[model samples]
Target: MRDVCVIGLGLIGGSLLRAAAASGRTVWGATVSEVDADAASRGGYDVTTDAEAALQRAASADAIVVIAVPLPAVENLLRQVAQHASHCLLTDVVSVKGPMLDAVRRRAPYTRYVGGHPMAGTSRSGWLAGDTMLFRDAAWVVGVEEETDLTAWAEVTRLVLDVGAHAVPLPADSHDETVARISHLPHLFAAILASVGAQGGPLAMSLAAGSFRDGTRVAGSSPDLVRAMTEGNRDALLPIVDDALGRLGAARGSLASTGGLAATINAGHEGALALEATRDAARSGVRIDLTAADAREGLVALGERGGRITGLDGAVALGEVS
Candidate 1:
């Protein structure tokens, strides 16, 4: 029987444990807190507290230790498992991969490690929030490095498939960059927008529309988790934020320019279409094949339609062909 050990009992970790158990695998879950261990045990995990004991279970059972702990805590867990789980392949569910990959390389060089991030989660936390379908249809990014072993990568891919998610192979840097734009930047924007909304009076909040709620959905996530993502991935995140701000500034300039308002309005329509196109592409697996030229064309079209491209007169002009 294959034994899998999950090091955290949070939503992602808990869900993996549940899925493994459902797959007829012998799965054990560990947590620092007794409450979580008890909850996981009740939820059908072979629960334990001893790190070495958990590592032993993982080592002997063709075990793959899924470290579901926070980003900072991951390094220690990997090191601990490396010491006791020499035979087990290790993986993690961290959103930011670059730093975690670096830490693993430095501290657990001898361990078979594959970085994993299932692009599925909710604002909810804890073992009770786990669901077997949490990862279904999600794009699971598997970060691979030069030193990664094929067998370990294959096992990690199997785990991803077992949980009903498709594996997307990406280098650590590429994974971090792509997620910074798609996931991390959006979280930061949501937090900012949510904070702005809170400053509005109660009457303003009472009249909030679906757009506001939808835009700020991720703001309800744990602040600590968001903070870690912001700081830990700051190197990759800053440029995305800069790009967002650049777009916003362009939009604002266009809105203020004479006769640019109509084109700016048309830009909003284009934006909606673009968003829909992105969603469709993701569902159809087209996003995985986007190229630099495709991205450049999209950005150029957006700028042209938004009336942000300056003409020879150095003014935002409508009907201008760039």
Candidate 2:
């Protein structure tokens, strides 16, 4: 197994450190957080507060470096990565991919880099909140760009698969757009829902049940972390937010005019069912030849069609499409 080095040992990063080490990969992590570093070290994991030393060690060991920081801190971190591990096989767990790739190009141009985002997490942060099984069966986007290094992509794919998550091959732009709706938008909606529920006083708080709890669950996440992703993906998220507002406006108009919410409720119900159907759809096995000339394109198309790379078999990727 390829050794792994993770920087920024928060929930996602810390979890990856634990999962990768458990998968028989020699994994070590660095975090500037003294508390988190201490916690991870006490857990019998190789962790350090000195990120620079970790990066230098990763460079020497030819380890795959996973940048596990939020979007705002990426540029600064990339500078450190450039100084230490400029030629390493690099990937990241940052939520927004487009900006992350941009930062890599500008700061660490020599690194064999792929952008990645694991579509998993909870309203938690720091090392103590990390769970080795957090990414189990989740969709982890392994970036595929026109100029992407396929060999490095495969290495990163292997690491993701090793940690018990399936890989979703996508270009950075497409990944940004998709997550803006499904991930970022939900965070915003959760914040709004929580605030609205709070305004209803003690009676509403007492009556809050499954729907309210589920809807507002992510709202409990750290505000800074939420802003880092949601605002970072705002370009893609803005249009979706507008579409949502327009739908709400129409619903309000109908409620005032016809005294009914049938259209709004029915649309939501149908959307939910459609999502469930897609999740439950039968999948057929498929293979992607990583050595082929059009391999990256094939992978992107597969992911766009709701396919997933379950595990790799040498240069041929083992996968299925729904």
Candidate 3:
């Protein structure tokens, strides 16, 4: 197992550090948050607040570095990376991928990088919320761009699998667009639902049950974190937002003019059914030949069709698709 060095010891990073360590790999981490650093150190993990020092250590030991931080802080961290570990095998847990990929190109141009986003997390955050189990059974998207180093991509994919998540190879742009509709849009919906429900005052709040609580759950997440993710992916998110608004407009028009919501309700029901169908479908096994001429295309196509790499057998990718 390759040594792992994770930067940013919050929920995702701390959890990664723990998971990597548990998987029998040497692991260490750094964080800007003093509280998280102190807590992690007390928890018997090797952690520090010195980002450059940590990067330097990763450089010395040839550890795969995981950049786990907010979008706004990525550039600053990349600056340190440029100075200390510019050629390290790098990956990130940032939710948005396109901007991070672009940032790496502009800031740490020499680092062999792969962008990743684990399709897992909760409204709760911070070091204390770290859980080695958080990523189990999750679909972690690993970028496979034309310029992406296949070796680096494989290393990142292995790390994802080691942490108990299935690696879903994707292009950075495709990841941003796909997540805009699924992740970012849902956060916005949760916020909107919470806001709208709050307008009903105390009586509605008192009467709120499973539906209301579940719908507004993500609205409880930190506003700054939510803003950082959604706004950072604004370009990809805008069209999805427009589509959502259009559907909402149609629903409102139907309610006002015809006193019916069959179109919107039925569409939503079918969409939900499609989700279940996909989940319930039997998956077919596939082996991705990474040594082939069209390896990058194969990886991206597998992700496009919702396949996941369960593990790797040397350079080849062991995967399944529904």
Computed on alpha carbons, the lDDT of every model, listed in order, comes to: 0.73, 0.94, 0.93
Q: lDDT by residue for model 2 over 49-92, one digit each (tens)?
A: 89999999999999999999889989999999999999999999
| Model 2 residue 315 distance off true place after TM-score fit, in angstroms | 0.3
- Sorted on lDDT, best first, the list reads 2, 3, 1
| Best-to-worst TM-score order | 3, 2, 1
In candidate 3, stretches whose alpha carbon ends up further than 4 angstroms from where it belongs are none
TM-score to native of every candidate shown: 0.82, 0.98, 0.99
lDDT of 1 by residue, 1-322 (tens): 3568888878898898888788777788787768778887776578776667888777777688888888878778877887878657889898888999888878877778889998899998777888988988677776556666645665676777777776666667877887898899989989988889989979769989998999999999888888877788989998999998987887788777753666656777998899787555522112211123343233234322321111111111111121
lDDT of 2 at 64: 96
Model 3, C-alpha of 82: deviation from truth (Å): 0.4
Q: Write the per-residue lDDT of candidate 3 for residues 107-199, one digit (tens) a residue.
A: 999999999999999888999999999999999999998888788889999999999999999998899999999999999999999999999
